[model samples]
Target: MNGQVMKKLLKIAVVAAFSFQSAIVSAKLEMIDRVVALVDSDVVLASELVRRTNSVLQQIKSRNQTAPPLDKLQAQILDRLILESLQMQMAKRVGVRVSDTELDSAITRIAEQNNLSIEQFRKSIEEEGTSWAIFREDIRAEIMVSRARGGSVSRRIKISDKEVDNLLVQIDNEGLSRVQYSLGHILLPLPEGASPEEITKIRDKADKLIRELRNGANFQEYAITYSAGQNALNGGNLGWRNASQLPTLFSGSVKNMKVGDISEPLRSGSGLHILHLIDSKGGFETHSVIQTHVRHILISPNAITDEKAAFDKLKLIRQRIVDGEKFEDLAIEFSDDKGSGSLGGDLKWSDPGTFVPEFTKAMEALAVNEMSEPVKTEFGWHLIEVLGRRNQDQTEEKKRERAYRILHNRKFEEEAQIWLQELKEQAYIKIIDEN
Candidate 1:
């Protein structure tokens, strides 16, 4: 054969090999970025699902938590991705966004919390086999989801004053008000306006679940397999919340159950729940609540008696009281407060904010059964007596404020779960199985 012909054949062979190698590389990229799930107008890529699954697995390991099956974990991660895509789409529609500056600040704050610099944080993330770019995307996505969630869930939470007061009553009775419970929950959601038959069926399922959970069945696995709660993917972890912070339905069950004890199926507005008390920490917490039983003898300055006469009358009245004269008698005869005077000037037990600022200060300063000097209030010249002081009284304002927060959080949790379920039910989703 001619040398030219041999060289030409060799060059053609080399070109064909290079083309085949490029084709292999292209296939690899396609496999990595292939669509695993379609969520509304968005797609979750294979690479994303893999990354998220690995991250979750690592987190579970770090926390010493038992993970569910790989297939279950993957499905959970894919569902999460689909939900996140839906949220991001909603965020875009509503103009909810995290600016680059805000995102940077969030990242900086995370790093600071972890006691690391940005560069150090980047290195740490990369060391865990995640790219820095992907981590930023994760952070951005998290912020967008949070904003979207707040917009959707905040409106659903309506804490009525009566509801708050009810919660306060519960809190007051709760001996473990500040004790935190780390719970695992499995929700068996009922259909809207479910029939009695349906309710009984769900209750049976919940009861079975509680039995299994208490009898050494893997809670995380059961949760991933059956739970309808939003945190089902995270092994139904509701994380940590104090008794007051727990949902009203849950708080009652939790206080009596010991750690690792699973509650019998409990029903709420949403559905039946099987609760696993993963852990508990903390003890009783109480606020200093001081109440003073006070009585005031008010002598108003009238046209007949000038301010000086009123003041002098109060002084004389106070002197008479200090000289062992009957306060009730003086209050009835001279006190302008017709109602209180009739009751021996008995104001009963008063909370801190019950009185005017001046009156409250004077009352607060007086010891039990101690008489105050003639103090001038908006009412008139006053002779005040601290009949008794008690610390067990509830501060209505603070207690109500705490109750409001607890109710809001409970509402938020319940609402978010329902909202997510509705979102998935409403959206167009398609999962492309790897198989």
Candidate 2:
């Protein structure tokens, strides 16, 4: 009888231990893998969403703010992942890729921006508990996505000379200086697949909130309490935005409103929005522009001349120019910028923002008659010489350039919206876990 009781106890203990081990193993496997979302043929894994969410959570903590509920945050992150997956798929189909060399160069540029060397950047990421390899891959993916978006959007943007002229006239009518708005926003979200009654309720709620705001309620406090936007916790502040940069829905409304004015409830597909103007500045700022007259010998790398070779060649050319070689002769003989090379590399007088940021910055740093060290721009490696500087009255050329830029920006925003919506509507996106 004693032996039998002891055997029964031993059997029970073994069974319990095995069951516990199995559960531990099951949890570990589940934690590491699962499909969170599906974008057409591709899926966003649970692990990927969690990793990205953790990064955002860290940012929130560093800002000393309370994070939203994990499920809510995860759902939002999952949506982003779905979009990224779609874009990446498109990128793959279009044969868009960021090469290893490009990735390395981009990483190095980022490191330089952060005042660190590439190795130091790796150490910094490791110190922050992120893998360097993973970081590099993340950057490469970002570049791919950016390139993909550009490819999709650029083809759709069309600005004619007539459109540019019309934009310039509109700007001149509005006065050269325009008001930049700092806005406080409140969004009453319209749920996905919301019924007409539900939409009416949200819009009515927005109207009530707007009335309350007009009746002397604090806008920031109201935004925090009532807004369903991403910035609700931060009081729905849109920060300062030029009219051109404002959301298409808000821009027209904001343009007419004065500082400290509250807008009527504006309806959009996503939700009802109420905006309070916080402040206004600039657009009233005069264009006391300092113009620079500069010229450069540009050399773009081809299959025959790689980036390193182009850079080295420019460096030698710069040395020759410094050692009493005539810049115009060298530019005519060797520069690849056919238009400027034939003109002895003379770009002529240009106001600020006329050129790309890299070219502008390097040119600005050089004194009149001083030659820049081989500087790299989107076009290519450049050896710039600032011929002169002056304070000039705004010219038609400058006005036209500005108008083209403004029109391009406005049209780009409008087109981007239409394009992105079309992409999303056509894509097959399925959420594995809705909650």
Candidate 3:
């Protein structure tokens, strides 16, 4: 009987052990099921979504403002997640990849900006209830998006002489000195994962700072305390730049205004720019000239299969030009350059320094209606033609306009927005929740 009792006791102990193991297994399975959404190959856990929502709420709270309604906030978060997923997908499609080292360096820069050691910064984020893994992923996603967008936009964008000429007209009207203001800026950047609402709140704060500056507050003091940009320590002074050097958007606003003037808040890639005109000199005399329309045929060895083949192909095209086909017609048929190919390879001109040296030299050497032999540049080979040329004098109004043109052309945010929207429309996107 005692032996029978010992066997029964052993069985009971075994059953208890099995029950404990089963509980652990069940708990893990439950955690896995808590994923609220899946973006392509990535999963967004319910916990993670909630954590981010709470983070945004905290930001709102810190500013002593009420959070948006729960439903509204949730919708915004969902949209943001979808956009981020789409950006990541597009980045991969474009073959733009960020390395681990790049991610680490970005994080280090952030930490340094915040006046913390890397370890300390990591700890601080952890204390705020965010893991290093999430932060690194966020940084990587942003960098990838920026790089891909920049590549796509830059391919199609150009600075034309007509644009420069228009700018010159504005400068003449303003009668402002063609001065290069030595300027510096200190920026206080927002977090990479900040939501639209958060961005708006940040902008409001920036506007307030701008107001204080306009009221005679010290620029450097405010920058040191609140600016998020790397140049914040230097008081937001961008070093010496001509009127042409200032972006077109800011140029017009600052034109006709004297030194010591601070601009109204202007938005940029990272954040708002509140420019202070440090000093101006050399509103020098200027000249204007009618731009020429030129067409060319480009032969690219890089695009061809072999060096001999590329050279031979270019030689054939050169022979055809020598034999008497219009260069424009040939450019339309065979040039590798896409920007001017459809327009008969016509590059409208104003300034001299715009084209590559070889292309420029070829153009400068040619008379109107003259076609050159195959000329080589880093991009490949080219046959250039000068369609026409005319001249005019430069004026202050022209200078101001030119400055404005430069600003308008370099508005990175506008370009980025247009590119992103195009990518989104072209992509295959399905929101599981909506479906």
Candidate 4:
């Protein structure tokens, strides 16, 4: 690991421990809790590899599947850990930390999704031999990694309004709605400008993988172990993609596949490829419009004001509103939004996508009359309250949104692969353990 990267990770660790002072617990270090791999400046501990490998083994066992060799599984898990470590480091540098409140909310949502209460969720994890703190930290790490990837990849992606319009036109040409495929992909990447002999070798490897997949080996497991795709660490998930949004090379094979069918080895410019159609749905999925009656007090940081100052100011403002002070009056007095400040911060009824992504996400998460904690956006910091919500007919708007999503997902997949490959190539990674 590089010294600079090590310092950065240590700094983040200290800050995180300080931030969660009360919750921080000291665990007695085991003898084997030493470095297994160096990822730039970060170290992947032997203990971490064992813990993650055990978790993966449990998952496979629960599925009634034969376990892969422990050494092989650990190698793949170690690579994933390295990628995660890199992302966490990047997230800290990019100011993409997930807050405790946000993490708690996410946990609550997870419990609800599983039809369990918070207590039940806790009990379940404990029954499975994992502590609540460990589960929470795992969840937090996942969110940080997701945010880091988005922050890093989003900047590289460009989706023009014209492109959206063009997609809408194409959607119209095909039909309003089409089949969406849930795809898992594996790419046996060839070296750049590879000789014909090297290409043949890679193709033969792809052929071997196909036979294994056909013989009941898990696609995701093998993808993680051997594939060199951008989403290899995510088990090569391309996610649920509309037919038009799929890579042109994949479209032909995918369109012919039934649910649960896996594609034969297909050669593309980048590599030899295999795809599994996990499921399919939505030839004509209906759409509806949900509008929020929202309002917010903005606090833009200026030359004298920093992000922390803006956040602190909004926190106090939010507290005052929670203490029964009039939100509109507070907005009128302190909001930096000139137009909305005069209007008592009343954004009124607005359809989704009208506001920035951060603002939209915060607003969507709020209950009617519930004010959010200080949230940051490109404009600055904000304290948002959802006044009301209503569902209305918005066929055209929904169509446009669907079109934009398809295009965005397609672009994101392409860019994410390139970005991840670049990160791997540029990073100073060394695997200490031999497989």
Candidate 5:
């Protein structure tokens, strides 16, 4: 494989390792004896499952106002473990591999996402009782599986003009509900106590980048390599995002652009920005009030030892709301969820199946402006309030277009899975069980 592909694969493997850490275990007689489950070429250990279980539980406790029963959690863990084994087998059959560079880049991306330096991110993981080596291996495996899937399935999928036309017709008939847009952005960041020369340099850089893009130097590549933003790794994808999802400064520019157009660089408080329109659909003249928001919360379990302690803390907060205190105020004061709690735990309007089951259940249970009791999920205790709900009557055209896209994805996955299974059946796999 090419170096780039190898790098990507390695990074993916690290992610996989982190994802499946709970399924592998090492022996520690002083602590607990490690047990092996199904051992393929990739070993599944009891310690790995335990680690994963704890990580999942921690996540659940963070967002949920309540916890799921242990039996349910165990089943979920086993399902994940089985899926991992299948993917790993597929990777071996396909001869998918990851390189060290890819692993480093993936780690870098993770660090950036957490707003941490690479060293700091590593330290954090290490502190959580995980070995970085194991993490990297997991990520590498994931990368291999992804490459295998893409190589096997993407080559066969074609986007035809007829398909596009049909999709458009359906969208037109249905009255497009979710607007998709193509956007390009140039950011101009201000320096502290910047002189004229510094500001000029910043603008000059943006201008140069714009010139290159206009001249047909791939914008996505430039964004990936040069953009000093979180979305850089995604090649500035921004992905079918809503206008309201953008910053106020860029949203207006995005709203005005047609497909395949570029915007003039505009200055914002943080920096200067230039946007290019890739494509857009739906939201022709109006938008539905409801938007689906998906969120994940991380809770530190150092404070609360048992489920009761966690539940009790959340329950107390709920009691305060029953006593007539504002939900937002309670969220700000007591909720351990930092991301949404600051906003009074408002997830904004979202579509169905957008949130974790527990969070969705709470939201669905509440009427408009109605507050829910402390509900527990894996995240932790949650008190949800439904802000509002709206059901837009979609046209037949929209339905067909949506159906086609969904079907295409489903088919791709199905084909990819079959291909991987065949590859696995042909490959040489050896299992070394140490436990």
Candidate 6:
């Protein structure tokens, strides 16, 4: 669907069925397409369905995966197109749009993600058969669908504090403090009738064994040769055990020991034991995640202020931010997203999922204290800044945040299907049989 010819073909067909009359078009041109399906006030043309089906087939082939029967794939893709058409209609009804600035930013992100310059990405797309013009419209459609989906779905999915608290309780009861360890043990046992002198001999032997293991002596080899523990035959290899499952004495000692470190003699009533720190897992350190502290000046276009004016205003705001004007003051004075604007545009410390995809991407790419050029979204333009960032420990704040997300996601999937089903049930949809 990407080459120059298809690009021209698709561009023509995509634009209101290229909106030319088929009789007139056929009179002048050779190619003709028919409606495959009729959506509420729109049609899914045969050309568009074939184009998408081929794209899916090409993707499957590229991945070396077996393609499904053509009939089945077409049905699925046709259903998908029907849904998109429904959503696009909704978008038009609501005045949701993909502005040129927003489209350009999205394309830039796509190019960057592919590790290609804009020119190269364009060249690659055209070479592959999709014209840049058609490609842009496709991206615009994608963005619109996303906005539509979010607008429809987000309101239905809400996570309560009570839900988060209950989940955290469940997680806590399931042992949040446990860490697992794989260890090697060597036991120098005391003879049953051993005197104090005999105990000293075992302790010294344990100390000596630890020194040897520390200085590159093979711990498993030593365990098999000199240890009297039950696992001594298996090179004293204590396969993975949680902290609570470990020997009372070895449990506390292993927590502070680094992997590969052989402990000093852990004197249990039965013997003087030596432990090797083989490996550990599932500690709090693993919960570290980066969170961004970000803020922005948001401005929206209205009848009085066009998209250009909105964008131009944000550009000046960003430049002032770069040149040392306080972002908070400017945001308070100028931002149209008044709720956050009153707070100096401070969205506060947040994960990337806090905002729309475009905002998330722009925020993720900024450094601490750095400002971004105006970025576009459905809401309009924004001049964003990364106030600071941190690899925060997963404290209570993080746990609840994650719990909220888990509950929200679980409900979202269930609700989104219901929402879409309702959309279908409520919509005017008719499929034209090829037969």
Error of 1 at 208 (Å): 4.3
For residues 78-120, what per-residue lDDT tens digits would candidate 1 score against the true structure?
Answer: 8778888888888878888788899999999999999999999
Worst lDDT 10-window in candidate 5: 292-301
lDDT string for model 5 (207-312, tens) is 8888877787766555544554334334456667555345545655776777776677777544556677887766653323344333222222345456677666
Residues 1-435, model 4: lDDT tens digits? 567657655665665566565444544322323468788767787767877887777776776655656767777778678878888878877888878999999999999999999999999988877789989999998999888898777787777889878877877786536778899999876555789999889888888888888888898878767877767656778888778778657876887899878788887656788999999887775667788999989999999999899999999898888788999999999999989998999998998899999999999999998889888899999999899999877777777887777766666766666666667668889887544
Ranking by TM-score: 4, 1, 2, 6, 3, 5
Give the top-scoring candidate (lDDT): 1
lDDT of 2 by residue, 353-387 (tens): 99999999899999999998888888889999999
Greater-lDDT candidate between 1 and 2: 1
State the TM-score for model 2. 0.61
Task: Please report how far candidate 4 places residue 6 from its true position, in Å.
Answer: 7.1
lDDT of 6 by residue, 124-241 (tens): 9888677899899999998998788778888887767787787678557755335678999887765445799998888888878778788998776676567656465355788886
Give the top-scoring candidate (TM-score).
Answer: 4
List lDDT for all candidates, in order: 0.82, 0.78, 0.66, 0.81, 0.61, 0.77
**lDDT score, candidate 2, position 411:** 68
Clash totals in order: 0, 2, 44, 1, 54, 5
Pairs that clash in candidate 2: 177-283, 178-283
TM-score to true structure, per model: 0.65, 0.61, 0.42, 0.67, 0.38, 0.48
lDDT head-to-head 2 vs 4, winner: 4
What are the runs in model 4 whose C-alpha is more than 4 Å off? 1-30, 191-197, 211-221, 228-240, 245-248, 266-270, 285-393
RMSD of each: 14.2, 11.0, 15.3, 11.5, 24.0, 22.2
Worst 10 residues of 1 by lDDT: 26-35
